[model samples]
Target: MTQPLLPDVRRPANGGPKAAARNRAALIVAAREIYAAQGLDAPLSAIARRAGVGQGVLYRHFPDRDALATAVLEENVRQIEQAAAAEDMSFADILGVLTWHLKESAAFLGLLHMRGSVDHSEALAHALALSDRVERALRERLPDGHRLGAANDLMLAVAMVSGAAGGPEREARERRAMAAWRLLGVEVGTVRPFDA
Candidate 1:
């Protein structure tokens, strides 16, 4: 594959591949924490400070703020995928996992939505691919109901969570939406044809 548009800085004498990897990981963690506390508009310098790394180190791993946000979001999506794939997890369980991630990563999600048009286009593609995979997996486990595909219901659930603020309000909003899905029979571990 072609090289990414943003490349890391060349390793110095004291820093090798291992150091680069560690720095990259640290940047992601710091970005998540900083973003959660201060929103996506928080300065990149703040994230660098939180990671205990210099601004140059942060820039080496992620050339721009969008790059950093994408890295954080990619990690979040991977985690949600793993949660959904857990043994015996129902659709409701999967939605819970998804919303929880969404709530926690609201800043990143908002950043993506606000910067939807351009910039970080590749990251946007990767995020969409990850989401599509999860949705397809969930769809396979859901039965056709009300002539709607599982993906449709999944989108609606996402829309519901999109309006939610962080903290208890987020959980409450997701719970209400899940309850509505239950009423509509848009869940797994039910009398759906797939389970029969």
Candidate 2:
């Protein structure tokens, strides 16, 4: 038999119920907000209460906060992958996608920088795979003169603040975003100066 163009991989056949996706997504958001406010010490029961779902229902969907946290990150990763799917964008446009990703996902990054782990290791693995896709999109989007090194630099710059500062230090984070813009080749310097 001739080999097919792409390798086959096994995954869940079911995407799950549309309503369930919405509901689980809501639970993930609620957990993130509560966890951001109180860290992981916040009770799952309280999260269930805040989510307006019975404890069993919450457990059925997430089983534990670990699963819930992973789900949140996964959702963000999915969006990033989707947005960066374009392979023909100009370097600047591609860079814009990176900036928008980490900015819109500031809270998600905050959770990651703060929480750092989830029970299901596979979730984090999937997140990283999605990141690779983002990088690929960036490389494909860059102009003829652009070096891959710039893409790496942009990734680091975005992480420098969000992955480092996170939390109530809103001003500093904004500085990081602006710095990231500059690093991505925009001429503007730190719009609001601040230390890392």
Candidate 3:
């Protein structure tokens, strides 16, 4: 069956009415992929195409690029929260989850760096708060003497990973992330063989 061009734009903003929520979720998923692949300057039309929706439907949910970017960050924050809250997750696991997110969402994280210019103040605040929560959880999981340093190093790791340019710098980025873990005195290649 052929997909609809756009979500039924007639739905409400709460994303409550099933169809609207589905469209919103699809747009978010598409936006993440598009932004990461094409950079933040990518046209909204491209995002709409990727989401298999019309531009109007995309606008209905995210009035502007910043709005869509905000949604992406919001989702990233949610993922981090879930990882941090996982009871079975160890410190290394949490760090790995966060590091992987940083690598995957490097472009979106760049949007976070453009704090003042973007109209995503609320979203930025939410992301920052979530990051703090992740760091706090990691700190709590750290061995007694390593807590503070580990937390500090994790933050540094985020900066390093987020600042990296993809493609040629991909290896460098991975190295820097692992190096930050090493800075925390966490043994790399033990919990995960990330020696690459």
Among these predicted structures, which one has the highest lDDT?
3
lDDT of 3: 0.64
Candidate 3 per-residue lDDT over residues 96-194, each given as its tens digit? 765665555555466434433446567567666656665565566665665446435656555544554343244565676676666656653322212
lDDT minimum window of 10 residues, candidate 3 = 187-196
User: Candidate 3: misplaced stretches above 4 Å?
Assistant: 1-16, 111-134, 147-151, 164-196
The residue ranges of model 1 lying beyond 4 angstroms of the native Cα positions read 1-15, 88-90, 111-127, 140-151, 166-196
Candidate 2 lDDT over residue span 84-131, tens digit each: 454444455444444443444444564334324554467556655555
Instruction: List the pairs of residues colliding in candidate 2.
Output: none
Error of 1 at 94 (Å): 3.0
lDDT of 1 by residue, 1-196 (tens): 9976887778558777888898898988888777766777899999999988999999888989878888887777666566556667766566556555555565535533332346556656766666666566556545456334643655555544454434434446445545555565555222111111
The segments of candidate 2 whose C-alpha lies over 4 angstroms from its true place after superposition are 1-18, 86-127, 146-151, 169-172, 183-196
TM-score of each: 0.64, 0.58, 0.67
Note each model's CA RMSD in angstroms: 10.9, 14.7, 7.9
State in Å the error of residue 41, model 2. Answer: 4.5
Q: Name the weakest run of 10 consecutive residues (lDDT summed) in model 1.
A: 187-196
